[model samples]
Target: MSEPTSPESNPHLTLVDHPLVQHKLTLMRAKATSTATFRQLLREISLLLGYEALRTLPLTDTVIETPMQEMKAPVLAGKKLAVVSILRAGNGLLDGILELAPSARVGFVGLYRDEETLKPVQYYCKVPSDLADRPVLALDPMLATGNSSVAAVDLLKEKGAQDIRFLCLLAAPEGVARMKEAHPDVKIVTASLDEKLNEKGYIVPGLGDAGDRMFGTK
Candidate 1:
């Protein structure tokens, strides 16, 4: 991730507004939606968001032969992308993106928030060794306080990942602002930029605990 020249604001954030993504997000947000349905919708929506997240990946020409004739074709350049999920909830989005880019490298970072402090504590992390050679797409379902998100990126940067992007289902203004101040170079892609986070540090009117909702843990 490139260090942001502007510390006061973020110009890297992207809001995915595709109709299908919007519809799926709506269904997922409904209180009555079943666990199975919510998980399914998350996967579908992630596919759409993944397309947007990777839209600017570098491409190069490759020689290929078709039945009709031999010609040069545009193909992705550089090493395969590294997709790192921020653990449990991130896996929901990771699975969908894999459907779109099956050959991409995969990694995981496990973090759980300390309720009283509202800070992240890392428990596990295992990422590709060649992360510096490839662009990384970091997946997390919610950007609530942005602490965990920021921590995740911090570790990624420490691991030599220069090109990084964050994908989430919902984002709070507080979270976006925090990320801007911390990792200005990372672009954040989300389905909705919701209102402020509640007192306990959850996005208001946001889909609750993405992991629990997707895994039926709640």
Candidate 2:
């Protein structure tokens, strides 16, 4: 995929309009798609999104030995990355990103939204101690209300994370607005910016509850 398309509403957001990602996302959105297929498609799309999210990672010049002779090479600079999953749904995207970044340090922040208020409730959080030094990628399949996502980033920031990126399969305008208001400094990488959220805080025209479909849960 080439550079992501930045929307006028939020320049920090990058819409990954890659054809392959859109095609797989369509399959995943179909009501008839199987659980196994949805999971597989999510994994595939995660790799693509991950590619865009880390596209601007800093690089440094270094001397390397080639098959013939030594030469100057550019390589990834800075500390190992921290990939933080926002509990269950985030794990779906986490797997593929880990495959793309095998050496990244993994972390998890458990937060479930309250049905009535749609606010996040945290239960668990265990992240890398060096978050202040390493970049972080926070994962959640749906950026619905951006409640849980904002809460997750709050926790990461409290833990000393300076650089952070939010990753999702689909995002709604309300959620994106919420994220922008709460954490404008963080960049957002998503597959598609869909219509507004429904009355119950679900993304309209979305592929249903990502956690349930991905895990065969409700």
Candidate 3:
């Protein structure tokens, strides 16, 4: 998520093309990948994506005494980070990120897309306090049509989340464009930006439905 190898127009978007990430993604993408394996791979890849998402977090040096000597150590600064998942499917990514930031303030925004319109419908939303003070990480595995993502971000901003970063495994160019147009200030970190979304509003050349694959529901 550090470089822009794909659509270079959007400065806020990051495509994580590291070899390890790509390797795991390929496995997850295959039609034969099982539910248990897909879940595990999502967890593993999320850890990597989480690493990149929080890469620019501010650090402050604090005095600490080591066994050898007293020294200053760099640690996270400011308010604790707020990790908000766009629920259900988002939980897959959330579990892995929580492992990275165990103490991070967790939140959820439940939004499901309307099948016919591909529009987001809010069912629930509860986020951390002092969102303006924390760096919010809003996550979902797929950024397909971007409607859900934009709606989610709009909700986050309404709750006073000024510093927000979006995390996803796969993104469609349409989704990226919509996010950029809707919230230019937010950064998008993803493993891959696939081709356009399909007629049914699914990311084409995409890894099926992330939630279904992760849960074996479909």
Q: Pick the candidate with the highest lDDT.
A: 3
Number of backbone collisions per candidate, in order?
A: 1, 0, 1
The whole-model lDDT of each prediction reads 0.92, 0.92, 0.93
RMSD (Cα, Å) of model 2: 3.8
Per-residue alpha-carbon lDDT of candidate 3 for residues 1-218, written as tens digits (9 for 90 to 100): 22222457887889898899999999999999999999999999999999999999999999999999999999999999999999889999998999999999999999999999999999999999999999999999999888999999999999999999999999988888888878989999999999877899999899999989988999
Candidate 3 residue pairs in clash (backbone atoms < 3 Å): 1-16
Residue 15, model 1, lDDT: 86
* lDDT accuracy of residue 172 in candidate 3: 89
Runs in model 3 lying further than 4 Å from the true structure: 1-7
Which 10 consecutive residues of model 3 have the lowest summed lDDT?
A: 1-10
> Where is the poorest 10-residue window by lDDT in model 2?
1-10
- Per-residue lDDT tens digits of candidate 2, residues 1-218? 12223377578999999999999999999999999999999999999999999998888999999999999999889999999999989999998999999999999999999989999999999999989999899999999888899999999999999999999999988888888888889999999898878889999899999999999997
Please give, for residues 48-158, the per-residue lDDT of candidate 1 as tens digits: 999999999999999999999999999999999999999889999988999999999999999999999999999999999878899999999999999999999999999
What lDDT score goes with residue 27 in model 3?
100
* TM-score of predicted structure 3: 0.96
